[model samples]
Target: MFNQAESFPTLQVLLYQGLKKITVVEMLKTIGQDIGPSTRWTIRQDLARHSVKTLTSANAKEITAEGVIIDREGNEILIRGNTVVIATGTRAVNDLYERLKERVPEIFLIGDAKAPRKALEAVAEGLAVGRTV
Candidate 1:
């Protein structure tokens, strides 16, 4: 996801975040591995730093990539590439087995989410089916 840059050990070049350089480790952690070297580093940095507040306008304008955009009064305009990925996942699809379940008669469900829990279950089910006939 990052563009290439000055690399180090155990890092993947993913995406470019504005002027700020982002690392692979940072990328994964941000997504949600929730664990890495900087995990400790972030904690240490947070402990070392102090918080403060800044004022802003009532309605903040949304920034976009296209068109010439600038900060404040179009002072020193910083051009940064921000990639936005929209993931609208639509996987409400059914499988062949599900279709069969809709048409078939005397459908028996078993273990692991309707799967056999143990080998014995399969054997017992087979035996019961056999006895039924």
Candidate 2:
């Protein structure tokens, strides 16, 4: 986001530039990193994925399939049915917003967008320029 005044002038100019000779799919593909969704949204399920139920605590970092804690402190580690495991990647700055957007809906992001290159120092410079300009 830019300052209140600078935020929309460029966007307004682009919007008023008259319709381009591009198809909707072409435009969405260009804007959405060249990959569009293959199918429409559906209230559907694929049965190949299995589902299991278990009560999980915030501290239950990892566990085995048979409802067993792989390494944790619990005196009542006694009885239970099958468990479930989900895999996720380590956190990186950009993708965290993509994943957690629903949890925090009012969101905004900005930086050296059209700049030719991306790097740690370049990102820092972009943020600094964003703050000032």
Candidate 3:
């Protein structure tokens, strides 16, 4: 989304999570994983260049006829837009693949089914698979 934000004239990302520096031990204990520092840096740079407004510690509270209301640290903010996108994080799921792999002679898993990452990575994989087909 950060990379594609340039296509939208106005885009705002409201994240309910807080941005803070934490110890490695705290991170591993709480989240059990971390987004690599280099990837974070690249995303930050892309967001900065693309003019993607980010509201950290903000969440969507309600959607009324007026617009979408947000709670940013207890302050109510009304944002009026044609579209509202609620983005949850991505995770890999291979339940169907597991069930069908043995039954099907040839089955190729691409994109999120293989591993959840950026869209470009998935697209590249899809193109490669399409060529084989």
Clashing pairs in 2: none
How high is the CA lDDT of each candidate model? 0.39, 0.37, 0.62
Cand. 3 TM to true fold: 0.42
lDDT of 2 by residue, 1-133 (tens): 7566645766665554444221111112122232235522121111111111223322333355555332123433422335333432223355655666688846444333333233664677767767775
Candidate 1 residues 3-84, lDDT tens each?
6755653232222122333211111212222335767666544423322111111112334664223333334343333642
Question: What TM-score would candidate 2 get against the native?
Answer: 0.19
In model 1, state the lDDT of residue 85.
32
Off by over 4 Å in 1: 1-96, 111-113
Candidates sorted by lDDT, descending order? 3, 1, 2
Q: Compare the candidates by TM-score and give the number of the best one.
A: 3
Estimated TM-score per prediction? 0.23, 0.19, 0.42
Off by over 4 Å in 3: 1-34, 90-133
